[model samples]
Target: MILCFALGIANMFHLHWIILFSVVCLICAFIILFIEIPLLLRVCPTSPAFDGFIRRFETNYMRAAIYFAMSAIQWISIAAKRTSLIAAAVMLLIASLFYALAGVRGQGFVGSKTLGGQGVAQMIV
Candidate 1:
């Protein structure tokens, strides 16, 4: 998120590039939302191996939600057509705050010790 914000700030003079970047990010986010998530949900229920794969990666649904929120905010900024860089920066910062809150609430990727320990054991075996 910091990287995206920094890129937006650095390219403030090139609004076209920022807009393009935001579009690309939104595309990737949609791909994950539409394709990857459904596949994961379908496979995770009946496939123990796939469940292990997901656990091994420490996938955080909370973080994914934050990512989706950030992508939506970027599109909103583009649509508003006014100080998009500033708007993106503020929105991304708010997203980061939600990310931190997720960590505090034990919803972060690899944040919970019990889950982290289980992941380590699964990986080792």
Candidate 2:
């Protein structure tokens, strides 16, 4: 969607192998997303609060992973190595921002505990 267009902007050439790799990555990502949905639906609740928190954290983590992988695909498309690296770095930053915001609001995984009570959780690469 939007991500595909953003990444396509950086794609300078239509290398068959790179395009193939990107397609494979995207397929794998979609598979992962599909598999996680059922598991998320089945997480049982021993405690109401803890259960709610876990569900939210899981959602955020999945979103971050998906976005990061999409950005990595874009990174693979750029022709200039240095420029690609920089673009990848920026993509990572944007992904981290999304992760932190989602994690903080979810109140799990380093929220209000680590990061100096800032309630922000960082991406795990």
Candidate 3:
């Protein structure tokens, strides 16, 4: 991932590279949204319930927002105005916070460890 990221960075200096990176990122983002959601639903059978719906909403929302933020990097790099840079920076930060809070660490969205412990493990099984 780091290597690909660095390569993308190196490509940013050229217009073709920028376009290629944009297309690739967009495709990957779409694939993640299309593929991961069903897998998550399968992994979590209660996904259509009220609480499950809320969890899926937060998770997918943050995931999409983070990808959107990531896709803005090229725009940020090419942006000429200070205001644009600041706006991009702010969006990136907010997206990152939500992404972190979207439960990647297996804890609940708010940071309590109630979702993935032995208790929940037994229920999931």
Candidate 4:
């Protein structure tokens, strides 16, 4: 959310550098979501430690992607002179932040070592 708002502020000045930065962030987010997560899962199918890390990793990148997408839409709206869509995009970004935060908090309480004592045994097998 902060990054989106910062990008919006930067957009107001019509900065060329921010455009490149935003594109890089968006591409990185997509790469994490589509490539890294699946590869991690495949490489550590039975490791509880990796499972927890992957879950948190996936959630964080998913939130980042949502933010980047919303920010892009907001930028487009501003360029097209559509004030209404800008407000809509801001609202969606807020909603997504809340939703993603809830998931993070839930994961925090659940603990990452879900398999407990059996985790090592499972990995050994």
lDDT tens digits, residue span 1-125, model 3: 23223344444455443445534444444434433343333354443563443344445456656546564663464544222233334454565565666556555433222433234445556
The digit string of per-residue lDDT tens for model 4 on 1-125 reads 33434444444443444454444434434433432335435444446664554456445446545555655655565554533345536665675576577676665322233332225446645
Candidate 1 ranges with C-alpha deviation above 4 Å: 1-15, 31-82, 107-125
- Residue-wise C-alpha lDDT for candidate 2, range 34-72, written one tens digit per residue: 333423223332455634533453456665765576556
Of the candidates numbered 3 and 4, which has the greater lDDT value?
4
Which structure among the candidates has the greatest lDDT?
1
Cα RMSDs, all models: 10.9, 11.8, 12.0, 10.3
- TM-score, candidate 4, is 0.31
Each model's number of backbone clashes? 0, 0, 0, 0
> Model 1 shows how many backbone clashes?
0
lDDT of 1 by residue, 5-98 (tens): 4545454555454566555444444433422243433433446664544444234444545555565656566554654454454555565576
lDDT of 1 at 93: 55
Worst 10 residues of 1 by lDDT: 34-43
Global fold similarity of model 3 (TM-score): 0.30
Report the number of the highest-TM-score candidate: 2
Instruction: Assess candidate 1 and give its lDDT.
Output: 0.49
Which regions of candidate 4 deviate over 4 angstroms?
1-64, 107-125
Of 1 and 2, the candidate ranking higher by lDDT: 1
Candidate 4's error at 64, in angstroms?
6.2
